[model samples]
Each structure stands twice: as C-alpha cells, then as structure tokens.
Target: MTQPYEVFVQWKRGGAHEHAVTVTASDREMALTLAKRNVDVRGAPVSIWVTPRSEIAQTSADDPTLAPSIEREYRNVSWYARERQ
Candidate 1:
C-alpha cells in the first residue's frame, strides 16, 4: 500500500530545509526517488529529505510550555520608530 511522504529541499549549503511537496509511494526508496525527480528538477537542491508523514512530530498550537521565555518589547520595530518623548 502507498503511504504519504513529506518532501523537503535545501536550495543551498548551510540553508534550512523547506517543505517542497508530498508524494505517495510504496516505500522509502520510491519516496526518495519521486522526491528527487519532482523537487530536484531545476539546478538541484543541496539536499533532499523524504520522510514518512506519520513519523514526523507536531506540537500543540496552544501549548503554554512552548511560549517565549521572556518579554521582548524592545525587539518590536515600532518601539524604535515611535515618537520619542
């Protein structure tokens, strides 16, 4: 039976792998093959990743533990651009 696989590609070295597309295949090898054919058709990515969709982990959107560790009011661009008192 075919299963869904997630495809990721890194366009350049030291870059992050970005989600490319999903492919359905019978096994890992076929998934990789299809990912290459579809994702690497251009200049070729620095790397390609094919992972079974079921194996990837996801976090709850509202998880409190995942919140930022500290307030960062100064990091906002408006904070610097606002009218100075």
Candidate 2:
C-alpha cells in the first residue's frame, strides 16, 4: 500500500533541511526519486530526506504547555560570548 511522505531538501552544505514537498509512493525509494526530480528540478539540493508522514509528531502552535514557566536567565550564555572586534 502507498503512504504519504514528507520531503526535506537542504540547498547548501551546513544548512538546515527544510520541508520541500509531500509525495505519495508505495515505498521509501520511490518517494525519494520522485522528490528529487520534482522538489528541486532546476537545481541540485545538497541533501534530501524522505520520511513517512505518520512518523512525525508536532504540537499545536496554540499549545501553552511549551511556554517558559519561570525566569531562567542564569541558563542563558549569550552575554558571556566575546564581542567581535
């Protein structure tokens, strides 16, 4: 049976992989091939990933449980970094 897969493409080395497109295929191999051809047809992507959609988990944007519950400034290190000359 075919399943829906999420495609992610990295356009440059050391860059984050962002969602590119979705494809339906019977297997992982086919999904990758389809994504490669259609997602970035004009140029080459540094890397590509095809994952079954059902395997992903995400929380709703409106969920309040992820909000910072308390002040945690002590844990932050941005101020400790040396300023560039």
Candidate 3:
C-alpha cells in the first residue's frame, strides 16, 4: 500500500523535538502503531500525532519562507514564572 501519511510525536512531558516532521504509514491505525513502535525503540513517549500528508498544508521551500523574524515570547517561561509566588 502507498504510504498514507506523516506522524508527529510528543515523547515526554516538557521534552522538546521542536515541531512536526514527515513519516509514512498505511493508515491512522498503522501510523499510531508505528508511533508506539518508535516510542518502544526510544523507550518513551507521552503522545502521538498521525496526520495524512494530503491533509497537511505547509509553506513552500524558499529563502525567508521559514525565516523567524517575529519572536514567540509566549514560548518562553522565566524562572520566576515557574516558581510559586
């Protein structure tokens, strides 16, 4: 069967792989199974994402296409914010 889609995984709480990437699978069920297999191989995972390639929309490859001029201040947490006040 043709590869149906891509899978994104959240391996653990507070862990970072940054963001999405491509993976191939026959269907969502198979993709989830593959994700579990990958987690078994890695020995950890908190969540998984199985999205069809046809279902995804993304920017095309080009200079400044992925440029990050704007800061995502919300993505950061200061030490003070992490502590109980």
Candidate 4:
C-alpha cells in the first residue's frame, strides 16, 4: 500500500492556511498531483504542501501534556461572562 500523507493549502494571500486533504501516494510527485487535482475541484489554492504523515509530530489524542498547570485569568476570554451576571 502507498504511504499515508497529509496536504495543506493556502487559499489566498494573508489568509490563515489550513489542511486541504489527505491521500496515500507512492512519493511526493504523486502527492502533488493529487493536491493539484483537489485544488482544481475546490477552486484555486494559493500554496500547497505535502508531507509524509509520519513526519508530522503531534500530540496524542489522550495527552494533555501541553495544558497549563495553573489557570490563567488573562487567557480567559470569558471574562465577559462575569460581567453579564
């Protein structure tokens, strides 16, 4: 079976880029072809990137290692919640 890969695309300048698609392909060339085809179907994408799925280091589904140990009041946007009371 072909290796798993992930694709990302930039739809427009200054727009926050996002994941576009995921596909299995033999190599980068094949992945690019798939990405281009998707771009055509989804309209023009400003930029594209394809990386092997294994290359992406990510947090585990059940891992909270990145969570802050202490609660931060400044980080709370819900401060308005108290005002509404």
Candidate 5:
C-alpha cells in the first residue's frame, strides 16, 4: 500500500532542511525518487529527506492549555526600557 511522505530539502551545504512538499509512494526509495523529480526540478537542493507522515507528531497552536497562566513581562523586550535621567 502507498504511504504519505513529507519531503524536506536543504538548499545549501550545512543548511537546515526545510519542508518542500509531500509525495505518496509504496516505500522510502520510491518516495525519495519521486520527491527529487517533482520538488527538486531546479537542482537547488543540496540534500533531501523523506519521512513517513504517520511518524510525525505535532501539537495544535490554538491549544489554550499550552499558554502560561501567569504574567511574565520579563520575557518581553519592552520590560527592559532604560530610565530617563
């Protein structure tokens, strides 16, 4: 059965990989080949990575429980203003 794969590409040596696209394939090898042909058409990628979509875990940004309950002004830069003489 085919599986969904997330494609990531590094445009330069030693650069962080960025999400390029998604491809469906029966296995990892075919996923890589398909991603290369489809997403890297310009030959800009220095490296490529294909990961199974099922393997990734993510949290929702809108989750209210993830936010801090108390005020924390120290975390913001505006809290550190200089005092006028």
Candidate 6:
C-alpha cells in the first residue's frame, strides 16, 4: 500500500528546510523521485527530505501549553515603544 509522504526542500547549503509538496508512494525512494520531479523542476533545491506523513507530530495553536506561562513583554513591540519613551 502507498503511504503519504511530506516533502521538504533546502534551497541552499545551511538553509532551513521548507515544505515543498506531498507525494504518495510505496517507499522512500519513490517518494524522493516524485518529490524531486514534482517540486524541484528548476533544480534549485540543495537537499530534500521525505518523511512519512503518519510519523509526523503536530500541535494545535489552541493548545494552552503552546505558550509560556510567564510574561514575555520584552518580545513585544509595545515593550520597545515603552522603553523609547
């Protein structure tokens, strides 16, 4: 049976990997080929990663634990404005 795979591409060396596309394949080799053909037509990517979708873990934005319990006022733009005054 074919499985869904998430494709990630790195545009250049030392660059962050970005989600390029998703492909369904029986194995990693096929997924890589499909991902390269479908997403890297211009050959711009320096690296590619194919991970099974089922293996990925995701968290919801609505989750209360997603943010820190303590205040982080220094990270806010208002904090900078207040400091300038």
Best by TM-score: 6
lDDT minimum window of 10 residues, candidate 2 = 76-85
Better model by TM-score: candidate 2 vs candidate 6:
6
Choose 3 or 4, whichever is better by TM-score: 4
Per residue, candidate 4 scores C-alpha lDDT tens digits across 22-58 of: 9889998899888788666888888888999999999
Q: In lDDT terms, how accurate is model 6?
A: 0.92
Tens-place lDDT per residue, model 6, 7-69, is 999988999999989999999999999998888675778999999999999998699897878
Tens digits of lDDT, candidate 3, 17-78: 43344556777887777666755565566777777878878787785846567986555576
| lDDT, candidate 4, at 77 | 73
Candidate 1 all-Cα RMSD: 4.5
lDDT of 1 at 72: 72
Which pairs clash (backbone N, Cα, C closer than 3 Å) in model 6? none
Each model's lDDT:
0.88, 0.88, 0.66, 0.84, 0.89, 0.92
Off by over 4 Å in 1: 41-43, 68-85
**Higher-lDDT candidate of 1 and 6:** 6
Two-way lDDT contest, 1 vs 3, winner? 1
TM-score of each: 0.69, 0.74, 0.54, 0.75, 0.76, 0.77
Best model number under lDDT:
6
Cα deviation in Å at residue 39, candidate 2? 1.2
Residue lDDT tens for model 1, 1-85:
9999999999999999999999999998999889988876666888888899999999998987876779976777878877454
Worst 10 residues of 1 by lDDT: 76-85
**Residue 78 CA error for candidate 3 (Å)?**
14
lDDT of 5 at 67: 74
> Model 4: clashing residue pairs?
none
Candidate 3 segments whose C-alpha is farther than 4 A from its true place: 14-23, 63-85
Candidate 4, residue 40: the lDDT equals 66
